[model samples]
Target chain A: MRIPLKIGDAFVYGFAVVLVIISFAGMYLMGAKSDRRHVVIEMDKREIYSIEIHEGMEPVELRVDAGDGRYNEVVVMNGEVRIEEANCPDQLCVKSGAIRSSGQTIVCLPHKLVVRITGAGGEPSDVDDIAH
Target chain B: MKRYIAKACPMALAICLLFLPILQGCAINEVREHSKNLFALNTWINIRIYAGREGPKIIDSAVRRIEEIERRMSVTIKDSDVSRINDNAGIQPVKVHEDTFKVIEKALEYAKLSKGAFDITVYPIVQLWGITTEHPRVPTDEEIREKLKFVDYQKVILNEDEGTVYLQEKGMGIDLGAIAKGYAADEVVRVLREEGVQHALINMGGNVIVVGNKPNGQPWRIGIQDPRSDGVQQHIAVVEAVNESVVSSGDYERYIKDVYQKTGVRYHHIFDPATGYPANQGLMATTVVAENSADADALSTIVFVMGAEKGLGLVEQIGNAEALAVTVDKKIYTTKGFDRRLTVTNEEYEIVP
Candidate 1:
């Protein structure tokens, strides 16, 4: 075997090496998850209260449904790590909730309040506006 | 012959790779050009003053003066002029920095526009949720309800004539996270003008105030981050004319990771003050262009929480205000007559019909 590889081999391997480096760099840059904030609103269309969770154990948005007028029936539960929204008095849920994730929660109340959750910064559009 | 060529190719490849870093270094000047700040990182900002022979030095003095005003008038740090004024909110008539008072007053004005969707008195509510730091623990409903009692923008009383600010309720606090950067940008620009700087750009983080065009009479190109990418540049909006603030409110930055279990769920920082939660507005990000940075800064958040449709309506309702909103589905909603101003990255984004 020659100490110096042939030019053909060098070019082929060099291209492969480039591809690998690029892939590795991109993966490293993104890491497990770099910057991306996806605002996902999960709620039954019929349900008026939408809870938003964002990196906070506390519910981010708690909408109070003045129109519905059944807060007690609206139940908000933050248990262990998972928060759930159920029917109860305005869900005073302020308490009975479980948002297992950092920014997770449940809201049974709307008009009377709102609940929200945030995840690691995900890009829905142009995020550099503030991220610098 | 084959061996020599092979060896030469590797050397050439190495040279190219080595030069890659230097090529990227061109961004240093680019970064400085786009830096938006004259002060060092993580330090109280210092914008270069350039009015005339007396400009730079005078501007420096003026900015220093403004920092003191901000300290006394800021809603974040406790017991500044704003805190005391907020304490005596009901008493009426106290003195404050004209600029600080104006900024708070402006925040109040924004609160009115969004119908309280943009309130500065959201500190209690925000702190309860801990949007900025880790250990984000969900507070009790009772806790939120009780704290809600103290979150009232109306409680932020500013007497312009008396140069005083007051918080009507005890334990009530104001957090300018909503608009301080913009306000700071405005002050820095004003200082630059006073210092006789014919051309300068002051960017407090992403909140930017572009004074006059560059000395070469060229418009400054500002890159808007793609709402869907990370550490990537999106569309660039070039500002040729002077005296404009381009502030964007996107759903990125200041958030916690692993907050959701459903497929691809991430949380954002901007919260909707009305619900004492993050806003459900369909908009992923909102950018505002205004005569000053403060207006751009505050309005971006307001419109973001308001959503694309309603947010545009709010901007239109104000008259002379323009906005660009990017929806979660990757659609860009820009205002009428703004088409000429915005540069879309590709066909991926369409101006909302």
Candidate 2:
């Protein structure tokens, strides 16, 4: 049996299509927006500072003091972070260079300071842990 | 027309319902993550657990266990069992905690396995260089020779019946720094498994051990740090592991940076007891993967000092163990068992047969 096209049926089909499209778009947009990574600075086993990094963000310099006249100069610019200067004797933190990827860290053992990048961005991290 | 409209409505509703469970599954599959970052054993320790509700308590217990281990094993601690043994060297046998006794026994085993290449008595030479200490300097050859007399593992006498350790030489010392972290990691794993944690990651300094697979059921991926690069993410290769330990010893870990810049020579921490100098073997770093973390830890150092050919040979002789040696010339040599397990990610390094 043949049934004539009805306005109500057309409305139902259109609504379903729109709903599916919106759901997909919502997931995509949410993923894109959360791609911003975070740089966390920890001193003495406590998180002292945390900042988000994204494209086109202004560069920021932070002075982290580790008491007893020790400090590390941290620079965050262009989605990359590094210790530009440090008063620690080893100076290993300064030589560690810039880190832009998630799970990267700059550590000053003498000062008990750790600057690390953490967060689950748009994509998951490739590795769970690093062996060195 | 009414019947047709009824059918269309139900069809559209079914389509929406199809995706509802998928979105819900994403939320349901997300197991709670409990993590702790603390400094112990003179290095940063990071532990993560995926067990629900009971994770925090488990982590606390694990931290306390590590602290206790450090208290017993640390050489710097005033009255640690190791310190007591060092003080009583050549005079008397010092009774130690079971943990300390077990670690010393394991150290001696590795020392024998590697034919003294992995000596615990290298502590005197380590103190001489003081690379990890605030005052790191290249010791004079004469000064090193003086300290090398005490770098003999055979001189360390262990009594299993009495749980005591004695050193035959007065100045001789035993440093568990190489193997203690791995043992601590193994201890943490035991704690997590007992508490029914199926998925976890324990990184004691750079010694990494993964419990089971990831929460999502995929194998855990571990990156081997690039020895030439200082950036943490600069890994030369990646390896997938399941309930196994991966450890690497490299010159880049601790070194005299000021001396390196001026002289272009890195005076790193890992020392060769034979020469009383930094192991100048042609390799830059060595990584070991094994079922036991302590074995992997001690073997990494042993391999680094043994160089590529000998190290790879040693790894092959020991079944259920694998190793990768990165040469100073940007080449990687791996044991036969490492086939299909390691993937070289850096372009500069070539995997040589």
Candidate 3:
């Protein structure tokens, strides 16, 4: 029995294989994008800023004006975030130090400000929240 | 035959391409999370609901419920039920909302159970110390002693039939700082469950109450904050919880940092009603896990003030509740049932038998 061998059939098979590969690569990239960590800054429950954090990214400094002459200086570098300075009374946010892990937060009570790091892929520890 | 093969192969690829988006949509449907953040009761509150399109509306209702509770219970709110009761101390019984009455009634019960270890009438002492204020200081011994006179829970008179509260002494005040957040969390959980929400996480300033398992059918992992660590996410252990509340009372929450750095004495916020001073019990932090957030919230403070041995004893006596107490010496004492639920992640601390 002779198998049907035609150039047109080979072209069809090649196109099918290429289509499958492209779809898989698209799915893989989408998955990888969700894993990227982002720093979210919220003031009075409103998100004011957000930036994706990745390895070897350029350091960024943000001066958040919380009105009434109050301000918080946020520094994001090397995949970690910290409040470099703040005019708030407590200075607790500055003292919280650098937070790199997902679900971690630095809060300023006086300013009603919150800085949190979150990853869509979920944290390695899988912690939903910290009981303090 | 060759033409048929080519046509069939392209048709199959076209069919696969058409189904790709539907499969992705199914995967997205498995995890539907809607979260909202707000400030209430002098703390940050985060509510996440994993339900259908009604999640956002449910969260809005939950926030309104919290605000209502705060208005009735907050000491700082001028027209609040608590404020009215405090202002009328020794004058007459002030009618309060049922929520306020219920919370005070529950608080008094905890006070009686812990033998005054957790007293809501410690408000005068809390004001004197002002640890949560801008200028937290080490109050003089004389000042603490003066406020101690008004630090008795028995002075809070509750008329359940009238839904009223009165303080026997004019100087006495009631502050629900220790347990109000828990009540708020439980209220949120109740609302979520009633609205057909199967999975949710309600965090009222670290008083975490999880409703059911995660969307993926896994238990929620709640990190128990390490008392000695300054980082917000640092946890000595993680507890797997399902339809339960986890609350911790720790010296690390608020303190007089200047005094601590100078005198090596941490003037923290969790006060001992008996002494009108910060609880100097051997334990640095105490975590309570229970079916209700309010009970867990009050229990964490009771255990922290009572120390390790006595605290764990009270938890064991309660039967339904479990506690994890971390000593100043880095020793963790947990209830019998807690052993199976907790996984120690930090090696700096050791679990004691």
Candidate 4:
């Protein structure tokens, strides 16, 4: 196939070059963290850890920091996982979709609970997040 | 890698010599450093030569070949090869450039590998929603569900010898957005080999395909974005990719930002062909590393829309392709060897089943 040497092609190509130079040369805006795809947190009442996932299927286990109060309800739906019913009023964490990707999350603020997705591949968590 | 290049060079050299003056030295060509192919949608593209001599004119010829392909494959051009072929998807066997036909053939192969989980026919649904266009608006459920009737990849028909493509349905359209970049990355590899480019890094936005290693013999360092953190994250992770391709599709990349305060950003690009709107799946992003680079690009989008479980299932079933998913919960999950390639931080994230 022959490349058409029309004026528009030149103009457009020229524009792209200029744009590339400007963008690369210009101050680079802040970028997202490139490593560590997940994070887990342990609080007073229970232990919370969020899991980050990619395009696939695998069983991920979360050892709920069952302190004095127990983990009453647990549920998994779609690609997310969350507590279906809890003692907290907000129930905000449960209301959110099953914690699926690094972007989607569940937080039990009152329980000081935080479970999130983090880096590399999805490895399991059998230990406590905090010393307390 | 050396073994593969050694056996392939002799044939490439013979074909390259026929255009001798146009392709001298095969490796360090002066003209190749600059001569722009005015037609290949002017973008800042870098090519690495793999097989031929680096003669000045050969790089220009190789780049020009890419420009020619850009013309042949662009969907916006009415007279281009893709348009004519796509226009006749149902009525006739639309003849096309070998490159275009090759992409279709590969997409078909990937479709089979993914069990139709990744489809090219999603274009109709994409256009109907007008996600990337200025007229972006949420389409009704009925509208989306109705159009999804033709969103099957199996409907794509191909004749390899004749280089023809046909869409079984009249309204069914093909969107190369998912895989075109990867194919372009492959084309860069193709041209580099044709022009004898031994080492190169072709980064089309996030779709990356590297050759050999860096000039210093170090593996390329590719940083996957930290979704929680702002801007480009500080952490740089090393990846082992010589000739292979790395492609990532994430929710943070493209979104329909609100016109006013820029709140309520709608992620419209990763739509569920089944649902006809943005995929309601919980996944926020998906990235795939694979042999062809382009497959990684297209498959990543398909897998993202498929959600983690189904998407992971599809990846495992397809084989050769490994994925890393960051669910909304901030956990990172990946296929078998994917764990080995990643560097875990003290920061913790949940790993969903």
Better of 1 and 3 by DockQ: 3
Off by over 4 Å in 1: A1-132, B1-59, B62-66, B75-79, B85-95, B140-142, B233-241, B260-265
- Runs with alpha carbons beyond 4 Å of true place in candidate 3: A1-36, A100-102, A118-123, B1-31
Q: Give DockQ per model, in order.
A: 0.04, 0.37, 0.41, 0.01
| Model 4, C-alpha of B183: deviation from truth (Å) | 1.3
Tens digits of lDDT, candidate 2, B39-105: 9999988898897666889999999999999999999998999999999999999999999999999
> Model 4 residue B95 lDDT?
82
TM-score of chain B of each: 0.78, 0.91, 0.92, 0.78
Residue-level lDDT for A11 in candidate 1: 74
B26-135: candidate 4 lDDT, tens digit per residue: 33233212211112332324343323234445556666666676787777778776677668877888888887888788877877776666677887787776755656
For each candidate, the alpha-carbon lDDT, in order, equals 0.59, 0.88, 0.87, 0.59
User: Per-residue lDDT for B6 in model 3?
Assistant: 66
Interface RMSD of each: 15.3, 5.2, 4.4, 21.8
Task: Give the winner by TM-score: 1 or 2.
Answer: 2
Locate the minimum summed-lDDT window of 10 residues in model 4 chain B: B30-39
Q: Pick the TM-score winner.
A: 3
Model 1, span B63-177: residue lDDT tens: 5755665676565556666666656645655687666677788888889989988888877787787755546645677887888888778767666667767777776777766
Angstrom error at residue B118, model 2: 0.5
Best to worst by DockQ, what's the order? 3, 2, 1, 4
Docking class of 4: incorrect
